[model samples]
Target: MNKILVVDNNPVIRKMLSSALEKEKYQVECAEDGLSAFDCLDRFVPDIIFLDLIMPNINGEQFCQMISGRKGLEHTKIVVISGVAVEAGGECEMKGVHASIAKGPQFVSHVIDIARKFTCDHFHHAGIYQVFGAENLFPREISKELLAANRHLKVVLNNMSEGIVELAVDHRIIFANPAAAQLAGMAQEKLLASDFAQFFSGNDQIRVIDLLKQNKIMAQQITDNDPVMFNHQQVAINFLPVHDRENSTVVVIIKDISKTKIAEERLRETKEYLHSIFNSVQAGIIVIDVETNIIIDANLRALELYGIAKPDMLTHDCRDLLCPRPEERSCPVLQEGKTTHLTTQTVKKRNGQTMHILKTATVCMINNRQYIIESFLDITEQKKLENKLHSLSITDELTGLLNRRGFMMMAKKQLRIADRNPGKLFLLFADVDNLKWVNDTYGHDIGDMLLVKVAKLLASFRRSDIIARLGGDEFAVLLSDSSPTGGEEKISARFESLLYEENEKKDLGFPIEVSFGVVAYDNYKPCEIDELIVKADKLMYSSKKSKKI
Candidate 1:
């Protein structure tokens, strides 16, 4: 019969181990700690010593070392029995230790198997050591708790997504979970028979070997981008090194990061496509982080528009780029919770030149983060063209003065201001005298020349004055604020002096004359521009009749 000495701090565990060993018809003795076991060993030498790592006096490590050095006990086998066997596998595998069994549901059975292996005939019975009537063997309460804990632990390990593997000191896999078997593309038996490091290839194998040789816990064995592969799947490896030199082992944890890696790769590809579109599109594009309101990215067109480099533009506040005034810094879409915004606005460039653009801002989500995409279409030239077209619409083609439509528009505005502010506003209307006779006598060219000359004389008024040719040899002027008091005398004298100078030039064959009407607007009562024109016209015809008399 094999003589086995069970040593542990827990009385129940020691009793349990001894009871199971004795059930196999072996001579078994129990000790509460390493000290008691050694005292028992002084007279009774066990063929195999079941040891516990943590004890009150003389721990298992010291007992193993002392027994390993002691004479007449060279052939005795040492088996470590401890709750921390998996965590301290290398520590438990001392010089004398033949095996290490974790204190679990299988612990008592492992003790029986080791005892039978050393003492019984080889190949006697290789199966789980089933203690018949286990209820009778252990106290009912403790037995239920232990069985429940073991069953729970087994369930958790078997169902875990991370591959759990425990290796022997010789690099043989001693245990493997279903996840490990799945990751290795093999059965649990095949995984147990194979070397764990053989699953890795090239530098990955080198990294695993280094982790084992270092004998330290490493959270990750390789870089994130370049993870270890098994069965054509990306996996991250974690190593928990056993601390004992004689019983050195490694526990590997394999996690499937294939989904995470694939997601990252897809994100990268999407960014590449966005980058391509950003530069290729004619519009300037900028990406902003909604949380920070910062410009996180800018395309080539945006960089060119800003006259800045991409690196310089990045990390700048979006408001700094888009808004020149502090009051305009608030984003309409972001602050108002709107989906998008569009506007025709002006932005200043690095060169301090103002640029007109049709800008669009949109809220977008990318990879679960909120962002604003601002697109700018340069409309500076387009704006210039629009203004030029507008000018042509309301401008007199012949005299470069406000046309009839433009005159009415501006005159109405000034009348409203004068009405509210109670200011002096002068309206002057003039008709070319003898213009028809000049056209009939000296030809229409000279008559046109005379009309142009009169238009020039009217322009001599202050720029604030509104001047217009109201069709045919007729012209009108709106003289405001800048006109001195007694404006009618000033107007008559100014035109008389201009006419005298033009007739003296002798380029014109005929003398230039004009009948003028000056009317003071009623500031208390506003009137339409056409009404003002009618009053001014009646006065002008009266002046013409007095001139004829």
Candidate 2:
């Protein structure tokens, strides 16, 4: 099995890498830092080293330097894992490392590729070793096998797209491919036997001649984006040592990356500009994965609106801030399968205060992943203002009773219930006995007080009864279901007693008196609410006329 070593200061990261590699059936080892890793290397030489750039006792650069001149560790390739950007640079070359991969969503995949590349390289060499078995093969057969392998390698090296050149210990170009000669702006035969350092300048900060002076067996990479070469092309180069125990030679691979480098620079600039605009907008913005609802990105305004710290908001489920039922609440943005959706919701904050928010979510895709771009604004104050206006429109401010419009709306709902079930329904229409006379004698304030008192009296009945101030000196009530024993008569008797007691006290500016007319109906005998009101009005006038007699 291929051995893989993970060196990171974080235990979680170390365990995560180890578990993933182990699951792949590779022998994996974990170390806290460079010191622990050094101890690991003494016993077991891994095919690949997963090294973190930043660690406690010794950092990645120091560890690379220490391991570079080591005799037995020559074939081990260092795959750097760093929190910072690991774009193409000369740093990897100086450290003589194979590749640098930044910590990101795709880091594990990069590690797998590195492991596969080196494993295959070693596998090829092992195949050759087995073919020329020391115990079984004759000397003549071994020499023939070696020559055949050399001829095959020569053909493959010449066909490669990347420029390849073999350099001697004195930094002389001993061999050059057609691609290397073209990069150097020279003929392949002319490029041979020339100093390799002649093609590069000091502005790049890397000198192959100086690097070769170390005479280390490990391969080193040297990359330069400076447009100082032939036709001003950027270059990425790697010098790997190949030797036969006593004599050493270096193989260099070069690739031109001018176009790719330029494209990435422009892309980065565009991203930064877009990020500035994202945060500057007034609304709170959040981008979350569609399936998981895991918050991927959140802006400054989002932080302020939710009263949350940045770190907590990024990982928390988007629904936890609004709909408490997380899994039950699928992405509202995608509910109707629309690309965009507008909605309003009430969300509770860390402070336990609820806020009404107007939200707009647009379905978006980034790097082949589905996401919802949600933008919202707190509308709590606006909602409060709307509720106040609605209340004034449907409620009597003086007595806090439902106004005519409010009563009609509610009466319809109650009527529907009464019509659906086998229940007795009663409508009571009442008029203040002499409200106009009281207003004329003692002013309208006392008249208002009497209206309020009458409203309370009407409200004191069954809780299911609906009370409303229909208009001036007019009130109505809808009673559902019959009382088991004491019916409306019981309610009327108590109201009379309360009125007489109030009249006796003389606390009000005028004595309390009200005239009532009742109309009854059952589900079997259905009638329109308007017809019931007209019948009750006629009964009230008849009662009033009888009193006059």
Candidate 3:
């Protein structure tokens, strides 16, 4: 019979528990106080302890802590019976108590059943045959055959990689394989009829009971508070529910998932470390669901850029987030099926401030779910520098207009647009008269100032016009939606008046004279933009010669 120790300050309660356990054929010892219980532990090493709180000398929580810290009493299970709430009992359980029972006047049988269930043996061991007279009945040959069969069965059960155990409906253990025994840190024979709760710590027993009652197969990693001894070694355990068809009994599989648990702990630590790094990163990061296009995760930089306290507020699409104007189609990231990179796209921040951002996106899978990782680098300053470099490359510094190369590029694009539309295109080619005379009479600085003034005067025309400094003392303008008869006359009159006003002011330090030739492409289609430019150039030379004569 298994021995039990019942400790309680209330003499009546102590007597009742002792009598009930004794009736169940268990050797029961009674202790009226925590001090007495501690004294009892030296001589009578009971298998289980029924502990009570609110005792003299030491409180239940303190006693449990002391007992749990002791090495010699490691296998002795302690069940707390207290007047406190279940939560308080759970706290005590965390201190390494095996289970807890509510203090009440009734339910003595239930308590005894709980205590006896942990002590019974449900399996027939090898020594049972000799003790029960089964060794003399069978012939030697039949006995050898039976022994061989039993050995093979035990070998098969022991070799199974998964921990397997069978329990009776009354919550008594019926059988336990070697794996199950190792997981629970008890011999298979000892665990055969033991109470299943003996294998679980206090709070976990409640959860285990709930899972078994529901008959649901649950898979989860659990951390043990009171560690169990397995093969003379302490180990963490993972309990997995196994489906059984025969006898409709519960078959639980246990595994020593200490390594898996360690890996998960490391993963959690790594995740927290990365989260810290992400928040401190300079670049903004946003993680979105590929299918729903919802922002699932965002770093601190992204939240700051969006000016939102939480990620849930931003409801606009990706295009709205990045584009200066509303696009007729979605952004390339959404339109393209694969990862993409975009440069020099204008994005509006939450404050309605517009800036340039260089963005890249990649598709990644996490926990079997697909997500898009979008990274944004602020490029407003970079873009400003790039624009400055481009201007230096393609613009005449003195004239403040497109140089020859820039003019050619703009003219080509304008001609393409003009060919597709029904609008008229006009080209004005002009040359400053007597530039060498101005340079020789006045200083070169004055001549340079005259060129600048001429470029400004041309730019003062309609914004729709494209003005360029073709070369030194030469300028070109491309006007769209203008006619040959009406547009040419209007442009000539405006040019004459502007030149007269400028010469009257003498801002150029000399009489500013310019020769101009205007040509209109009004249904007079040319094969290419360069062809039209050549025609206009020839007409300008003719006008210059005429003016000189």
| Best candidate (score: TM-score) | 1
Q: Give the winner by lDDT.
A: 1
What lDDT does each candidate get?
0.77, 0.75, 0.69
lDDT of 1 by residue, 1-549 (tens): 768788887878877877788888889888876556766877887878878877644467756755665666776777777765544435566665666776666667767776777686442243332222122223346544664685598799999999988765555575678998888898665565356678878887787777776654533365566787767788887777765633455777888899999999999999899779879999999989988988988889999988999889999987877864647867766776777888888989989999999988899999999999899999999999999888877888888888888888889998988887756898999999998899899898888888888899899877889999888888999987445577677776776788788889877855788887888888777688888889989999999999888
> Candidate 2 lDDT (Cα, whole model)?
0.75
TM-score of each: 0.60, 0.54, 0.51
Question: Total clashing residue pairs per candidate?
Answer: 2, 1, 2
Worst ten in a row by lDDT for model 2: 128-137
lDDT, model 3, position 170: 52
Model 2 regions more than 4 Å off:
1-160, 165-178, 181-203, 206-209, 216-218, 223-234, 241-250, 266-390, 433-447, 484-488, 504-508, 542-549
Best-first order by TM-score: 1, 2, 3
lDDT of 2 by residue, 1-549 (tens): 999999998888888788878877789988877656876888889878989876654457657766776777777777777654233133434455666666666667667655776777853353221110112222355544654675588689778888888776667666677788788888665665567777876754355565666545577766664333433667777778888744467888888776777887899899989889888888999988877878989988888888999899887787776553566677556777988888898888778899899988899888999998889999999999999999889898888989999888888788778888766787888888888899999899989988998898888866778899999999998886456654556655766776677688777845787887887765677777788888888877887777778
The pairs that clash in candidate 3 are: 118-195, 122-193
Best-first order by lDDT: 1, 2, 3
* Evaluation by lDDT, superior candidate among 1 and 2: 1
Q: What lDDT score is found at residue 236 in candidate 2?
A: 78
Model 1 worst lDDT run, 10 consecutive residues: 128-137
